[model samples]
Target: MIIRTQVSFSVTGTHFTPSKVPAPFSDSHDPGVIGTVGRFRGAPVPYGSAGFEAPEKEMAKIAWIYERVSPYKSAMRDAGAEHCTLSVTYTYDSQCALSFSQEELKMIVDLDCYFHVDCQTAT
Candidate 1:
């Protein structure tokens, strides 16, 4: 069976960089493409309807995407390789610092955060 691991966390503060849209109406449009949407590489910009919004909106998007991408992240880590991964989830209640509360916490300011894990790598 295909094994998958999931982790949930909260976000309070975040950093978002906006990018310019490439291929405006073309089918091959990638906002993540550095310089195409924004400047510099290795940076993520807000996408979707709220593309040209504020950082807060982008941060909210970040939390949303992270929530959707499950298992794949942990699965990759288990294989072992020179890849970038962050386990800051579940440990951080907010985006700025590493603080978690026993009670339900919001991922972003005024934005509700939800998480779920399917596999267990450690207690």
Candidate 2:
């Protein structure tokens, strides 16, 4: 029998850094030196946060892989089977931060496997 599973979740975090001006230019500068002076005030840049859904997808995939492989291998051994094949498929939904509704991300993965076991028969 073949089995498949799909999973999803929302993941979010502040993963991006705010842009900063160079060290010397960022510090206080004399106003009289117009050409050399740097602007002291600017709009606060918004840092980017990680999307919430990625981790969920990763965990789901891992669980599915483990479940499918381990049981199948055990079954094959118990049955004294010479070979077995395993396959996996996964799909991910759009992931976005709670603050942003328009942002979306998606990922998908698929894998296939073949296992072989051999037993020598008495001649």
Candidate 3:
């Protein structure tokens, strides 16, 4: 079963500040990330994370998450992001699968973004 959901986006570039991305939950800047595992590859450049960890109960549903993020498209586009990724993270205690609707997929396409889903199963 799902225990937590984080719907977020990230942008990276040498020319833009990440804090400018419109994220209400939280936002941060990292010089880089070091990775030792498969999914956590390291990035050695300016990185900004759009606020996630949506507190609103409705955000757990992907549609709502997309809706919440929709308004920030312009900010993301202008965030000086040489590249951008739109992602949804699920923290769960069991095995499961996720599905998406056309509307959800459209958001990614609309933004011309790379989409990734991170499923972390609790140990």
Per-candidate count of clashing residue pairs (backbone under 3 Å): 9, 5, 0
| lDDT (0 to 1) per candidate | 0.28, 0.26, 0.62
Off by over 4 Å in 3: 18-25, 28-53, 60-79
Number of clashing residue pairs, candidate 1: 9
Give one digit per residue, the lDDT tens place, for model 1 in 14-107: 2211112221211221234333443543564322111111122243433543443332333322322122222222222223223344321443
Looking at model 1, the pairs that clash are 6-117, 11-107, 12-94, 12-95, 13-95, 19-37, 19-38, 20-37, 20-38
- Give the Cα error of residue 70 in candidate 3, in Å: 4.2
Residue-level lDDT tens digits of model 2 in 36-59: 223523533222211111223353
How much does candidate 2 score in TM-score? Answer: 0.21
TM-score of each: 0.20, 0.21, 0.60
RMSD (CA, angstroms), candidate 1: 15.8
Ranking by TM-score: 3, 2, 1
lDDT of 2: 0.26
